[model samples]
Target: MAALCPNDFKPIGWLCRKKRYSLKWKLCISMIFVLMTSMWINPKLLMSMLTPVSEYKKQDITPVKNSKHLMVSAFKDHRINGSTRIISILNRGQLQPLFCIFCCGKNNYSTPATIDMHSDHFGFRYVTTDVLCRNKPKSNAMYVTLSLKPDVLYNLTDFLPIQNQIQEEEAFPYEFTICISSLFGSYNNVLQFVQTMEVYKLLGIQRVVIYNTSCGPDLEKVLHYYSEEGILEIVQWPIDQFLIPSRGWNFKEHGGDIHYYGQLTTLNECIYRNMYKSRYVLLNDIDEIIMPYQHANLHLLLEDLQQEHPNVGVFIIENHIFPKTQFDNSGQFNRTEWKKVPGINILEHVYREPDRKNVFNPTKILANPRQVVQTSVHSVLKNYGQTFRVPPDVCRIVHVRVPLQSNLTKEQLFVDKKLWEFEKPLLPNVDNVFKKTGFLN
Candidate 1:
């Protein structure tokens, strides 16, 4: 036979030269060749060899997923292995790392079905296709397995304005009132408290009514001044607050009048007369300050709160001991010290308002504001009084009394203990009230 050079390539010559097989290689090669040739020659044999890839996997692979059924002739007759190859994508780092496996295009079908292959391990099976997306063609025809679940993702939307508007329209029905006694001066310790309370207007408390039992003419003048200023409301009772206990009536904790329930007669009267006008009534001393950062007014705050529980919305705020530094009055023991407590803005004004600094509580809305009430520990009674929850949002009961140099609260005890307990304490500049009420006359 004439020697044929490589340039005379009839494919077989080049194949024989390049793929020179040893005996063992030829043996395996002969087997594969015989298998390929014999199967191609007999149509029935080829059909038998080309069973569904799913059958090889002991499952059924559809036209999209079956490897054996994939015709690489869909290529330019340049045949390649038709099975799918799994490529793993880099994981941003999680337990079951994500992958970027690839396979031929014609084989890949539904994304969920492909994911099932990795999760179910139904064995490798794929189809023939060009790995293309849009008009951009992949340099190599391949299928890539992207992360089924990615750590980060984005969405297109516009859905929060509706939620905001709904919240705005629903805000209403706020009602709260503050109750106190002594106007200003008689029980000087509470002067700081009165100042602190001025901040309550920002918290929904619009009106504060003072019930006076035993204030001197000076106190009346002070109250009258505030009343004219449109800030204070005064209700006068001619008797001393202390005489109630001797009359077999004790409004405070010390003296219990069996004839009348343990509650203060005045407080009981106040409840009956004003409960309807206000959704909330605060039973506090002039030395006590109720603090809340919820709303600009107590009325509006209660309305928001009423949305929480179906019943029972009264809240009892615990007392916080204020700092002694707040009471420092430059060594002055006169009524001026009691008049102001100095706010963050003014060092001279003892009655200056403090800055808001407490945390808010998560609140449940009450169904009925009328259902709430509060009682003193001294008031021996059943818990059945209409009650409400004091959400942390509006929670505060600062008893700025006792242990201060101002002899204000302690001085009152000597006057008439029962009276002091039943009625609220006084503000400091109450003498100004006397000048206004003409009580001195």
Candidate 2:
């Protein structure tokens, strides 16, 4: 028999073996397609039947109540409008916001933020509160494992496997400098303090400006030493050069909080207006230390914040006071051997609820300084958009403000018992915590 042609009407190749069987098979396939099409017409019913069913609906946390007028949970154990364990911060009138607080995590993305992933590789849409309530979608495992990585992994993975020429400029993330002005107090170490200054240098910190404002000469000496060592710029508002009354930098003594803060405001406005424009400015006293993990510096954090949300200013800090007690006029900072690294006792305090003990005086400075015009009681006076707070682990700017090394010394803090003896009763107990401290009694 002659071999059948490839497209013979008699059937060939795939249809060659058995005409009867092939016809039956085609008939069945066509019938199945028709059935599928009919089922698809009522797709939800089909999905209910054919999709793998989970017995239990995934539990999403209770959605945040009143997101627009964000209510940072009244400090833990402190009820809103009721309990008084921690002071309730009520937004009185159309007052300017101090810092935008968020509980974050799951509920954050539950209400899909209208995003444009392609336009800028990062964008946020103006979504009305009602829109958030209506179109929120449930997220699943695939969304996280396969999706979120595209932006971060693209640059981090470096794509060395395929081609090495990916332009770093197009990388979603970019580096920015975080200038920390670690001033020295009377209690300091010359060699060791310089070594501590080296941490910022190692993490690709391009510039470090130390406000060598010390009551004694130790910190100034260290700054001078580091200045020669090419790690820092030593500038001092010496005890002699103070802006306000005598010893203006002593914030904890003799109503220094007010004077020191005023001085900080003047200095910030001056420097921010003059010499340089930094992307992230941290307004911390010498006691504040901003430590980030895995060498993921400030630029990296800001890039992530910018990626997650478009615009933001200052990052409010949650201060953790150490030793879990009132002032310790003991245990001075003693450095015996020269060149020995100054040991910092990371006095881990009792862990309180995050929103509680992690006290945020919104005014704690960290920001694009030029963007802000002035500052009020823990509030930033800004010229533009709203400020948003991010997770602390992403940025832990620690404040070691109380019972400082100075408290351990013989030199009385400018608290001058003689001067305050008469006016003690008249001083304002502005904050409840301050009222309790009695320094303003």
Candidate 3:
């Protein structure tokens, strides 16, 4: 043919002609045909093939590293300023060059983080630390990766979503919230836990945040019930999976890696977690209740206190141990229905031990979380404003547990019936919870 038209030419026929195409060219044509066929069948296959492997990994969040020497629990965007606060538990006295790699899709902004080990680690080998990273200007970072090198693509912790950006003092979702740190030891104190929750409700507590490492089945059911009711937020804290946690506060005697199940970390995390959510956060144990003696409810108590002591961030309430061993002779709250419960009935324990002579009594806190920087079990370590120690007559934590004053007879204990004031509402509320959780059924 003098000039063959393009439509009359057949590439496949030409390739099939003997010795018309080399082996290399034939293989290349076959690959091109297969690829084009595949693309025609599914266009997405070509896109996936073209995409880099590293880009595929960005789809799923990596599992948080707990087994590492430095364990990060949560990453929060500090509302006071556009900074990143990484709540972590790390080995004490072990220096490491930790960097915060802020991830914004494919790009990362690496910055040096100031590692501040909590002063209240109590000499534990493992301590809670706050890794602070200053935010880069005009950065839209979404996730943070803590690593020795800035090029780390793993161990990323997504910033906790801020439900409310509280710019005004009056813009809090909850007026009062309770923070109970690291509940462990298969804590089956169902009765006390319920009682405390009821007491919290009566005291105007809108929410309770419990960091639970472990609990019994019965307590788990109660937790679930309260969680469904929107009163309790149970945070799953598997601290033991990360490090050797001590049951006792002192590391020398307890001989564990971390102090009291990384309680300091949980407390601080709770504070920051609820900083924009709650107006005041009460840091106490499940066995304790921050009872307001002078006021009708906690709101009223706080209102009066805040008015009197303006600019006070922390209000330290003295903890008074109401011995479980000794009960009120009246037995007014000794209901027969609660006999089957697996925990101490707090209503019956009203006799609080007298404050020891020349000894510092341990206290709990009701704090303005936004004003706090760092906290210990009993008090705030760092805060923006003043600290007010509330008089015992005004408010105190009614702790129902073992007798702190073992030597003192029951008669010597002070008869503080502050908890009894809410017995009317507390009883019915607790009974309702029991019925719903199938404890009574």
List the RMSD of every prediction in angstroms.
Answer: 32.4, 23.4, 6.2
User: Which lDDT tens digits does candidate 2 get at residues 12-108?
Assistant: 5445543345788989999889879977786554553443323111221111223212110111110112111111112123222222121122232
The reply for model 2, stretches above 4 Å from the true place, is 1-192, 213-215, 238-258, 270-277, 293-295, 324-363, 376-378, 400-441
TM-score of each: 0.37, 0.40, 0.84
Best first by lDDT, ranked = 3, 1, 2
Candidate 1, 147-180: lDDT as tens digits = 3333211110100010001111123333556666
Residue 124 CA displacement from its true place in model 1, Å: 92
**Cα error of candidate 1 at position 302, Å:** 2.5
The candidate 1 region of ten consecutive residues with least summed lDDT is 156-165
* Candidate 2 lDDT: 0.34
Please give the TM-score that candidate 2 achieves against the real structure: 0.40
What lDDT is obtained when candidate 3 is compared to the true structure? 0.79
Superposition error at 65 for model 1 (Å): 99
Instruction: Give the Cα RMSD of candidate 1.
Output: 32.4
Model 1 accuracy (lDDT, Cα) = 0.35
After superposition of all CA atoms, the RMSD between model 2 and the true structure is: 23.4
CA lDDT of each prediction against the hidden true structure: 0.35, 0.34, 0.79
